[model samples]
Target: MMKLDPTNLHRIDEGPPSKLQRLIRRSRRRRPSTDATSRMAARLASAGVFAAEAPTSSGGPALLDGVRAGGATLRRLAFGVGGGALALVALGAAWSAWQERPADRMSDAVVAPTTADRTGPSALGTTAAVDSAAVPQPLSTIVPVVSVDELPSTRPGLVATSSTRTEVRSSSPPAPRRSESEFAIIKRAQDAVLSSPAQALDLAEQHARAFPTGELVQEREVVAVEALARLGRKAEAKSRANALLTRYPRTPYVVRLERALGEPLSPAPSTSGR
Candidate 1:
């Protein structure tokens, strides 16, 4: 080959070598030895381990501090929610208490009826007078005029005039005793109310003949009223109840009869009969 000019052989200001030439030169370079490669890998692994184990710049335990901060924040939130719920419940209870206050006050302020209420018939036609009349006549009559002097006296003085009067009255012939036949008839009438209402009617009619004006007669009439009603004699029952109410308006049984008849009777006694 001709002697190559230095300028041509050794280029000075040329751009980088072509891609193929650079690849060829790199392929010809010596590769590292196996031991040297392993040593280099160990050094790199040690550096990575040192970096992983390094302390934080903030001079604090980052994970533990973060966990403590989160726990404190959660506790505060829980406390706030619990307090709000408790406040709401307390407010609801307070509102309910406030709403009931007026009703409680009204109940406390209401007045109950006094003894004067016993003087007149109730809404259902009951009065102290009617209750008194239901007892046996002698006891009923004596209750209204009760006096301490009427009682058997322990003192020997003053002659016990009231006691003497009571004794004399007791010794006198008792008021005409009720006839046994009439009593038996009235009792039969009462008994017939459940078994034979028509027979009760017959017994009541017989009682009326014997003891026309007896108080027991009125009771028998009430029994007869019940029997008639049970027998589906509504018209007759109503009529008899009205007549009984008219005749003995002050009788204690009138209210019960009126209730059975499904009507309200006049509270005052009828003037025409009594």
Candidate 2:
């Protein structure tokens, strides 16, 4: 340090400020103004919290979207399952209705002819309907008969009478009419069993009367039993079934007759007190 000169005695000397003092001065100059920061300070002071809002992830919104998607999928699955069940129920009901329909066939009834027409030419030929174009001609009309007198002959040994009697004798018997086959008749009666029970019964009786020892006797019996069952004649059906079983024990129609009678084809037990 040096002493002041006599001429500079009235002047004074000073040094620069330190680093800490300069930092304090700069911070004080950079602080925000009171008017701009007053509102945020007042809000924080009233709530008694100085902490800021924390940062968060998008997990909550993502979870909500996932839940909504799951619910929609479940709803669609339930609707599809319900629709399928309803369709199956409707299909079952239709099948049941179709299965429960009546067994009688109108076509069979119309195709089979009555018993009275069995001897007719139309029935003997075929079971088909008559054609309009192929009509048969009618029989020739009958003519009046006239008697003529014959003169006497002059022969020696033969003597001719004046009153002559006309004797008309047919040389040959009338031609035998063509008839229907036994199998065809039996089939017709059998076909009518379900549609027309009364006609089937009559045809069966006619068959028995016409051909007692026919090859299709067992089949005829079956038709009769079926017709009786259809007509609600349980007693008659049972009697017929018993008779058929007694006649033909090993016949193929035995099963049908048994089913119709609702029992076995065996004979009834002896109920005469042992």
Candidate 3:
């Protein structure tokens, strides 16, 4: 309650604030400005660092380009494989078709008849007896049948008496010495050997049944035997040779057949009169 001098009291009341007091006052005033500054800094960082890079080109073209390149490569590979497979299939089918075709169809006309020569007697031999009708006219003209005594003894087994003229002893003409079809097949098969030995073998086998007792049967057997030997089928060649010897002992090819059988034929003696 003691009254001090007025000037001294005023100086004491107006004295400078302490450091801790200045800090409290300054914090209160700077709160809004600090918040605004923080917001500005956050906006700048987001714009510079977080924004997405501008696209150089749309992704559609890049994706489409990759797809196109892959598709082109795949298409090329598929086409190559498909074309090659198709070619192989086509070639196989063509070869099969060729193998199935008849040998005669592939041969020339003149050669076809020669192949027929290997087939035995015709149906006419079985049905009709030899007479003037069966006798070949040219041979009969050259050697008239005035009597049976004029006929050659070496004539083949088919002969018949004429009903019209009993005294005229005419014989049936010889059956064609060969089959037209068989000859054609054989000729073609022989020609085929020049190109394909395997095909020739197939043809020979197919035609063997038709010429069982033909004049050329022995020759055909020889051809078959040779073909088998050339193919390195020694067993088959030997078997064929044995069959030929058994069936046609008088075959001219007996020497070759015997040789193929591993037993060489003895040489024919000199025919000169000593």
Indicate the TM-score of model 3.
Answer: 0.30
Ranking by lDDT: 1, 2, 3
lDDT of 2 at 63: 18
**lDDT of candidates 1 onward, in order:** 0.45, 0.44, 0.41
Stretches of model 3 off by over 4 angstroms after superposition: 1-180, 258-274
Error of 2 at 117 (Å): 27
Q: Which lDDT tens digits does candidate 3 get at residues 137-158?
A: 2333334344466555897653
Output the better candidate (2/3) by TM-score. Answer: 2
Residue-wise lDDT of candidate 2 within 82-191, one digit each (tens)?
22211111121122322333221121222223311342332122222111101221112112222333233564453322221122112222334345445445656755
- Model 1 residue 192 CA deviation (Å) reads 1.5
> Which of the two candidates, 1 or 3, achieves a greater TM-score against the reference?
1
In candidate 3, position 7 carries an lDDT of 68
Over 4 Å off, model 1: 1-180, 266-274
Quote each prediction's TM-score.
0.31, 0.35, 0.30
lDDT of 2: 0.44
* Index of the highest-TM-score prediction: 2
Relative to the unseen true structure, what is the C-alpha lDDT of residue 59 in candidate 2, on a scale of 0 to 100? Answer: 40
Clashing pairs in 2: none
